[model samples]
Target: MAELAFCLPDLPDVRDFATAQAVQSGMSEEALADFLVAVNEVATNAVTHGHPTAKAVLRMWSVGRVLVVEIHDEGRWTPETPPGQTPPAPHATSGMGLWVARMVSSDIRFETGAAGTFITMSFKV
Candidate 1:
């Protein structure tokens, strides 16, 4: 098991640390890059639209044949299943971050309620 916790601010430091940690964990260069991108998208969304004073917590662990990454934010944002069958257009620049995360990771889930919002992703090892 490998775990790290940090109260990341809405700044560049958040992205840097996420990239470093993923790379240090022996994740493939490509996997690490994808993980960093996904984590940043979630963190940025929390900072931008979730709420003020939001803090982030990240945990990574291995289970059987899979590696799991979980990110939690102290904000009241709910995750909804986009009501569509088709993915966003390739030319679209926005509204595709979460879609990308789901595509790269084997599994991605979001939980939200009065407590907070949490995003979890898994990759096959």
Candidate 2:
């Protein structure tokens, strides 16, 4: 597995790096776009909603024909309900990041606690 651990200032760089890593790991062109979109959305949320000075760790790995990417943030924020459990209201602008991520990824899982939140997104390779 490969990992990129960073703080808010490095969000963009991490996104680019993660994309490159995913492509290099044999992700298809279509999967690459979708993976990048999902990564950006989750990473953005980590920085915006997470605690001040929070850090994020992005890890990528492959198993069989599946590619897995996990984004972990060192913040205490927790959602009242699992994101994307239901579609967001139609006229809503925000609150769609997780929904978009869910739509693009093959599978998504979340783990949260007093320490932080960890989101794992899987894609078919």
Q: Which candidate's TM-score is highest?
A: 2
lDDT of each: 0.68, 0.85
Model 2 TM-score is 0.89
lDDT of 2 by residue, 22-64 (tens): 7877888877877888899899888887766767888989888
Query: TM-scores across all candidates?
Result: 0.73, 0.89
TM-score of model number 1: 0.73
**Alpha-carbon error at 17 in model 2, in Å?**
1.3
In Å, residue 31's CA in model 2 sits off its true spot by 1.8
Candidate 2 local accuracy as lDDT?
Answer: 0.85
